[model samples]
Target: MNEIKAMEKPIKFSDPLFVTLVASICCLLWGSAYPFIKLGYSAFDILAEDIPSKFVFAGYRFILAGLLLLFLFRVMSKRKFNLSGKQFSSLILLGVFQTGLQYMFFYVGVANTTGVKGSIMNATTTFFSVVLAHFLYKNDKLSKNKVVGCLLGFIGVVIVNFHSNLLEFSFSLSGEGFVIIAALIFSITAIYAKHLTGSIDVLVITGISLFVGGLALTILGLLLGGRVTHFTLESTGILIYLVLLSSAAFCLWNLLLKYNKVGKVSVYNFLIPVFGALLSALFLGETIMELKNLIALLFVSIGIYMVNRVSSRKFSNTLES
Candidate 1:
């Protein structure tokens, strides 16, 4: 019995690494989205409107992505599409916070700010998740290691943002505030999603969330006087790319979260800014200013190490207390 238990332990621990790899790939795909969005906005600006709006781009992409996921879900599962009253309400709330509000603020923020800045801002999702999980989910308690990790990660965020041309410490506050709020919304989504694991199939949950969120965005777009007539071939291509990649990433991410600790999975978000900056530089020819960028990379790397290291029995016991 003792020998069998010892053998089982290794498999149990190894399982999480596969999930982590999948989640990391998802983050990489999401990180690629920054440059595509930049290009799409530029193309739309030339062909459609003067303001270079993200509303039109985000609205179309999400709606299309949601519809695609719905079709896929129907084909793959013969299970009846039913939700309990409680589950239904939770799905609606998840849609509002996770998909609708989060994307809206993100799109608006990205539209106003540079891609590099936007990517760095999104890193706050992990830090905020640590804080939110401490208060919101009793199952996950904060330890000294987590506290130290978050502080280090946040310092990296500050360094990255400090290097951005868009960062103005003066009296004028504009897009930066919006982006920060967007990051907070993402954190809220992570915390809120902990309640959803056993209630619904992850694909179903993702489909419903996307569908409702897409509808909300469509309505908000109309209310804000955003016209649908601006869709062009270039914008359409960009929209397709965003939808496909985002849907794939979203599905994979939810699947991963089921098998791994949320903090462990979320550590991949730190890689986004790194990949985003590098991709922007390579494809978009965006220049990297050295000093602050190096410092940001160093801190982000350290944070990832701190967050991912598996604590031994002693550390686990200390964390539980």
Candidate 2:
């Protein structure tokens, strides 16, 4: 009984070690999203022109995720779904941009590009978040080490693409362009989410935004003639996994950002592509032992180490000063 109560205790945000454990779990779950989404595309038979269907699929995933989160929170904490008008409006806005626009762009973008290229491109979210944080928070200003670290991470992403014909420069605005745009959107909204979570419960914000955004996506997809096929037991099971990851990853990520520096937390995003590539190979039966993939992983790991070193030094200096 005492062990159960102890396990249920709240996370200690001030403890950097605990924050890293929680945040890393969130990133790992999100990293798995890349391959799972590709599998979803296959299961649902979502083709390139089936953009609307993608939206519908995402809608189902997130709506259920949101509802599940609400139900779990209610059961665990006995909290109600009470919210003021302002909170409701804020969540609506967060939902529109964060889950709605971000995933809308992501699904479409991934459809048009190779999985390798798409995963690498999507990593720009870290850079975007770091830059945006510098401007948004006085304490989170970009340092020389941060710039070096970000550049190294970006270079790692670029290196991974060298195995392909990246110089073809045939980047479609709707495809790779949308992926980049989605990263920007994610970065911006993450900052806003952190700010909002300062006042509102992370669970409330996550649930409301996911539900509102998901509902909108579902309506828009159906209106645009989008349909989901292959509603078999297997596909339903896959979808349930998606819902689980969405709820768990987003909720935990929001809490991490709320408690820590955005730049410090966001740098771990460099690992997503590494994980994505590895997982894609594992699940999708693609090649995994390529030299480029290993090299890319090394570069990304170093970048993560560099960024954290600087961030840790900064934190220690602040304490001393």
TM-scores for every candidate against the unseen true structure: 0.80, 0.90
lDDT tens per residue, model 1, 96-159? 7788888887766755666556666677788777767667656456776666776676676667
Which residue ranges in model 2 land beyond 4 Å of their true spot? 1-11, 314-321
lDDT of 1 at 201: 68
Minimal lDDT window, size 10, model 1: 1-10
lDDT of 2: 0.81
For model 1 the TM-score comes to: 0.80
The whole-model C-alpha lDDT of candidate 1 against the native structure comes to: 0.67
Evaluate all candidate structures by whole-model CA lDDT and list the values in order.
Answer: 0.67, 0.81
